[model samples]
Target: MEMDEDPDTLPAQRQGNIIITKYEQGHRAGAAVDMGHEQINIGKYANHLGIMQETELPPIRALEVKQRRKESKRTNKWLKMFADWPKYRNTKKLSQRVYKGIPLAVRGQAWSRLLNIDKIKSQNPGKYKAMKEKGKRSSRIIHRIQLDVSSTLQNHMMFIQRFGVRQQELCDILVAYSAYNPVSIPGQRYSWAMYPYSAWVSPEGVSTS
Candidate 1:
């Protein structure tokens, strides 16, 4: 095939109408519909999992990563030594000392040869699909951390108070995690429900002594 042949014109790379995702080693419970046109299926997921609820999303700063991977404390000590290169370079001849302020261009072919972030992402759909398939068939309990994290009780409070929807949807996330990683919760502690205005009353007469 030619480089610009447009694989969307081909047959095998069509998109499907059904989309389902679930943790590996469990049952399929979450499904989504793709009612739009079936376009190119090169497998793009750059913004698929854009949900920002998790704070551990990887940083996107190149310089930050570079600074982090720098070897010595004195390595970037001269990072700002020639910071004003644009102002000085025109008046003075270019030299190796002003290399810190230089901006480099990234070549597409060079990127393809060096790192393959695209290929790794493109493979996720198949992996997620397979995980859903396996998870639906197997039996297990989800974990407590995921249960708390995915719960609608606190995070989805606005959604519940506004649209009155997604309570079950959020609960399902917790349920899935709870089922996948079940731990023993001893029946010793009692939980309570407090009204918003309950702080006004005094607990002086209600003694537990």
Candidate 2:
């Protein structure tokens, strides 16, 4: 019953039961904790990025801790899988694992592998940088891209600012892609195509090459 145990190792029924128990406990205690001063204290330290939050209720905090622990266990599993990717790559088990969930820590790597990004980069060396430079020189689509960049993912904390880091990164990817493939139009649709990839992958790993 310890929260520290890896839920992934347990039987499906057992894992469900444990989560349900924790949720019920949190539900029962949620009202009492909301009426106390603990809510104010927890709210102050809560992460604005929404990655992690300390709830006002102790029971809910406990549930969150349990969930975080579960995610950590899953992340460790992914680390092992990534370490032996060749063996597991293109396997049904890999697909099942992805269907189960990809932990945020390894999500970018998983996506990169799935998309064959590294292979593409290898095949076309220096192409992404060259396209980026080309994108810079092209003024035809830059205005259209600029107009859509600010509105894409506007509510998300990372893209809230007019020209924030993530927004800029997104813009760069779209610009580069537009330049790399002139047939593709640069617009809101292109923003949607690059937004999630830019959001998940680090700057160094991301490319439209």
Candidate 3:
């Protein structure tokens, strides 16, 4: 037990005149291998669930989320201002707000208002239904729509399943558009498809219609 004596050089055990040998277990290395194996198993389990084993957010993404939350106040202000949008009639200000980018939560409503989607629908009553009815008669068009629908957003929840409601709706919409315009028939070699964009007018006074 002298301070200068090396512990490794000392005898492990002494019983009367007999010397007992000591064996050290390699527990550290064994534990490390076990941990690695457990990690692999955990990863396999996560894959079975179709998700990641860990849900930790990266530093950059966490910062982005924080920034997004901080910027939500601007979205709220715009929402309140848009309530009486017609009364103010400020397209210039609205354009500025759009250029800054709208929040994901309010993007749909904001774009709808900007594009006057309701007004457009009102102008062409039952147009969508009429087009859809015409599309139902074209088997070729339906087949093409089904083929494309199957591949659309395969990873997204809305379109992941084949023949899902969203996929069906998508097929209906695309087919309806194809039938709505004779030039863009599904069997046509090369033709322009006239859709809602056809109603849009550019600043240069050019109309797509």
Candidate 4:
């Protein structure tokens, strides 16, 4: 096989990346900004600020919380028996602080303080309200990302195999994306797949055509 010329001079792949410069810090798409790609709203990512914070709960403190909440309800036998709510509530300052450092939980209500629960919820309230509604999507580069999905992050790829994100989110975004841009589905490019409004593309890399 013949090797192509300098290869070094080939136009850099368009992709997305985190940029840390003297003036600003943020994720930038590869070599150039792709205006055509559908961007996830800033607020969705911003709402996860608590994931980076620190928490201060000793292992023992957690157990103590369960015990205390259990003891607090003694007014009625039924109430005491039904006092399982404390195991779930966050009245204790320690628990409140602990959730700060823990990985983000999927149970929406529990992670409220940890992340901007209400704010994020409010931002996408309509999507959540419509149980059948789909997730936001992007048709900008589904083919490109799908090509790389298998080789990208093991976690993402593996999760995509096992416990993938709810399909509706991707569906809604892609359907809407198709209307905005005309990229075909990865391997199924011949068939024009129309996604719902909520389907969307994640800004994972910077690659331009």
Candidate 5:
């Protein structure tokens, strides 16, 4: 079949320049051959401070992590046994286990027990709900946090779909936690509470965007 003549030279309206091509017609609706699409900014593409990046890896190193994870399963016995607080009160062993990194399956429970989250939760019933209520009332922080949370880890699988379940949960937790600890420098008065707030986007060190 015949192709259209050079679109630039063709007598057409300036705004409606049309160069019909097979690829453009079949796939992208408005990607006319003669249309000049502006190049996206280099900074936007390169400025991935918190975003994950692809990396080449040594097979041996990858295998070692995999092996460690497998061995971590054996430690589940100790992890479960530690739940009985009366029988096990060795802080050093607990610290060592934490340093080794608890298995993902029981990590949440282990952390809760280690941090005495249960005691705090029990002592302050509905405290988390109260913080969430406060967060909802604070429109300014909520708006800002919503915007930031929506963009956080935008390239990751969990966050790729904006406002997805995990993203919403992350946003809620952040907002609630901020309200729970409404202090810029938590350690200013406490002497040892100088912990800066930070978050890890993805467990895997790569963005599968």
Candidate 6:
């Protein structure tokens, strides 16, 4: 299913110190939504579990409203910056903004742009799919990866269920990476290495190439 044309306009709600954005689902149930050019089935989980919550410091009621307004203004500025990133990519202003902090709402997009994900994907077309297929055929380290995938981030709601969507994605990534780099045997630490990328870009956005 296609994703919302603009996730930026999605409704956001505050729970405790966490801000959760609600993404609309597609026509079909359990269909994956495109996020930053990657098919990730986060909409369902996000709606039910608030999976994409961004944490913030606890503030007083008035301060919380003030903070939200401040953040909203910053978010708008960042969005404008994203439209013409090349203009500010290496500027001191960009560095200053980064130093201040990237808004949680646009962090995923910001990370993808900063890391030049599109360029990497273009240079190595179909590599992820190829490695994933290779991973399915290869069996040397599958058992080890399976054992560690569940334990990597089990505390998080996204990975809490045994062999759930997120866990399977993690397993697929490790398997694909193992295939892509034959000499590297993925261990528990390898899962950790992939976690940060997956956290921001989703598993599909991770570049094994």
Tell me, by lDDT, which candidate is best. Answer: 2
1-209, model 2: which lDDT tens digit per residue?
32225555345435434433343233232444224422345344334333223342234477778888999999898889889989989999889989997876677778888888889889989887787656554424455566666566444444544454565666667767776677544442244355455554553244454
- Candidate 3 on 106-188: residue-level lDDT in tens? 66566667777678878888888777656554323344444565555443333443444454455556656666665654555
Off by over 4 Å in 2: 1-60, 185-209
Ranking the candidates on TM-score from highest down gives 2, 6, 3, 5, 4, 1
Residue 202 lDDT in candidate 2: 52
Error of 5 at 93 (Å): 2.6
Instruction: List candidate 1 segments past 4 Å from native.
Output: 1-117, 142-153, 156-209
**lDDT tens digits by residue: candidate 4, 1-209:** 11225444222111111100201232234413223222433323222222111232234467777754654432232233224544544456436534443222222323343354456656775543242211112123334333333233322221122112323234333433343344354534222333311222222111110
Give lDDT tens digits, candidate 5, residues 124-171.
888866765564444224444545655665544445444444554555
Cα RMSD to the true fold for all candidates: 23.2, 19.9, 28.6, 17.8, 17.2, 14.7
What local distance difference test score does each model get? 0.28, 0.59, 0.48, 0.31, 0.45, 0.56
lDDT of 4 at 143: 44
Q: Each candidate's TM vs. the true structure?
A: 0.21, 0.62, 0.56, 0.25, 0.52, 0.58
Say which prediction, candidate 1 or candidate 3, comes out ahead on lDDT.
3
- What tens-digit string does per-residue lDDT give for candidate 6 at 1-209? 11224444222111200200111111233324222212334442343224433332233478767888999999999999989999988899988998999887777677778888889889889989788766555434455565566466443556645555566666667667666766543342234355445543453244344
* Top TM-score prediction, candidate number: 2
Clashing pairs in 6: none
lDDT of 5 at 188: 21
- Decoy 1 TM-score against native: 0.21
Residue 175 of model 5 has an lDDT of 50
